[model samples]
Target: MTGSTGDFAGRRIVITGGARGLGAAFVTALAEAGARVCFGDVLHDAGAALAQQLAVQGHDVGYLPLDLARPESVSAFVEAASQRMGGIDGLVNNAAITNSGGRLAGELPVQTWDAVLDVNVRGTWLMCVAAQRWLRESGRGAIVNIASDTALWGAPRLLAYVASKGAVIAMTHSLAREFGAEDITVNAIAPGLTEVEATAYVPGDRHAYYLEGRALRRPQTPADVTGPVLFLLSGAARFVTGQLLPVNGGFVMN
Candidate 1:
């Protein structure tokens, strides 16, 4: 699905790590569906370029600088995005780091672990907190946390990233319960080894493992994950919350 079904027409969405990859896909799809979106990332030039590119195409998209490792940046980004979009109705927590990848748990440095959690776990939480007020005001808010299948399958040498995502899944549950009174839905999606710039560092063997293990038997793309995200943000999933969806071609069914 291209997310151009108009399900999000007139909606205001804020996305994180949206300069490229899955985040960029989300921005593009949502804009195509008539959503006014504002996205953030630490890649300043890229973020600006993406927004400009979308603007040239007549889409209402804005880009801002954000570093999830910094709490101040998280708050500022959310507030700025809300102001620009008039308000926030949906949030996509897609920014994350894998600083501990390829290192054994015993060999993983404490600093590396801390960095991953700071960006992936604490960053996700901060974004939620920053957007909570705006989302509540929307009266029909939705949150989609980008998790990873590596966490569900226990991928070795990825302890920090996996652990952080597991925490995101748990946070989704708690946030759902806490936001339910305001009609905000919180959920997480676990995508398997999608093809993206971030995954370029992954080993060939690891890629092969995911390909061979998947029922679809093909490399996953950012588009594969975007539709599920859009659905979660749409009115269609108003009653669906506190859940984890694995969009890995059945590689790790839940």
Candidate 2:
């Protein structure tokens, strides 16, 4: 896609986990692309501040507090965001938690497993279900679920996180089939190890591995994943659904 695509102009989009990291980038990029965007996150202060900053630039952006682990909040967030946006057209499921990485499956506590599944898998599903009505009303709705390349390559010591992402990919396929009749496209974007605030604790050697091992031989950034996401949300990808697009610089080819 070029800089001139009008796919986002006058559109309304809702993003989760938009307070920081990759989600923050999505809020900025989509709003700048001419979409009236409302983002939700657990970080009330940061999310509000981002919305304020974007509004100062005359961008149509709003923020709300959302807790993905709480199932009831999904429908509530969508209803509120749609009211703020006057309607809804797209959803980006980016909220997730890994809860202190680097633990074997046996060492990982039950709470860790539950929390990961509740937020990463169940949360994404509920959000989609809640937003489907608004999306159907919009007549050209789309969804982009953020997944991880770790699920594809079976990265070690992240059992819960990887499993949750794999579930997301599977749900994408099934949901795409269900929503196809409504012409609402559902897709997943699996990104590699990206340089973001959420990844600050990653070991230096791990970062080095990603940079050297990928075909691009460089680190992936928040911006690096935006183009593919925007394309999926755009009119250009209207016919593209139930597919997983990897934006990891050729790191996990399937």
Candidate 3:
């Protein structure tokens, strides 16, 4: 847990869907490490509360209302974050949407697919595009995209969510090559069955299936994934790009 001389000190970081779940964990960890974090989320009440709580702790954390379903909102949030934090050095594309209910593909509505794709894929892409310009200008920047292990192993009954995460994995690789020459390492973390508020929608059997394969036989927390995220966004992972590191508890060993 010993960070390198506050490696993120004076750095500006932007995280999407950072009000709760794993996204909030990243914000807290980075802010504690001395990074000025500007986060956006659709959950206004939670976002505002988290920001106020962190500010009380003397952390430079700012929250903005953002709806990832709209590309314009994503762009505007990034723009405002860049302006607010001075400049962008890192971005954590963690915003996503799951189906309202545990509906399988055969019974899932097209709207469910559209909703998931809009936020997980399109929103992530737009955020990266908006942040890319500033990251390039900074000359030292990194990106850590949040993907899911379900995408890699294929989760049943959650087709839309899995598909969107699969798209995120593909996007991360493509962007890594596009921004490699600029010295910006683009990578992803594919967490497996992490215990977060977001997983409340996951079916009980599905969760059991995920746990059965873990060597550790324990549920993963946001803290388990935060280390890999910070590593990717730190100087330590400069040479590591176009890689998807799994933060699962040995659930899906690839």
User: Model 2 over residues 1-254: C-alpha lDDT tens digits?
Assistant: 33334668889999999999999999999999999999999999999999999999999899988999997788789999999988888999999998737898889999989999999999999999999999999988899999999999998888999999999999999999999999999999999999999999888988887788799988899999888888889988888999999888888887
Which residue pairs clash within candidate 3?
Answer: none
Candidate ranking (lDDT, best to worst): 1, 2, 3
Better of 1 and 3 by TM-score: 1
Lowest summed lDDT across 10 adjacent residues in model 3 is found at 1-10
Clash pairs, model 2 backbone: none
Where in model 3 is the C-alpha error above 4 Å? 1-6
Collision pairs in model 1:
none
How far is 17's C-alpha from truth in model 2 (Å)?
Answer: 0.4
Model 3: C-alpha RMSD to truth? 2.0
C-alpha lDDT (0 to 100) for residue 206 of candidate 3: 77
lDDT of 1 by residue, 1-254 (tens): 12333577789999999998899999999999889999999989989999999999999999989999999999899989998988999999999988787899999988999999999999999999899999999988889999998889999999999999999989999999999988899999999999999999999999999999999999999999988999899887888999999999989986
lDDT of 1 at 65: 93
| TM-score, model 1 to reference | 0.97
> TM per model?
0.97, 0.97, 0.96
Q: What lDDT does each candidate get? A: 0.92, 0.92, 0.89
Model 3 clash tally? 0
lDDT of 1: 0.92
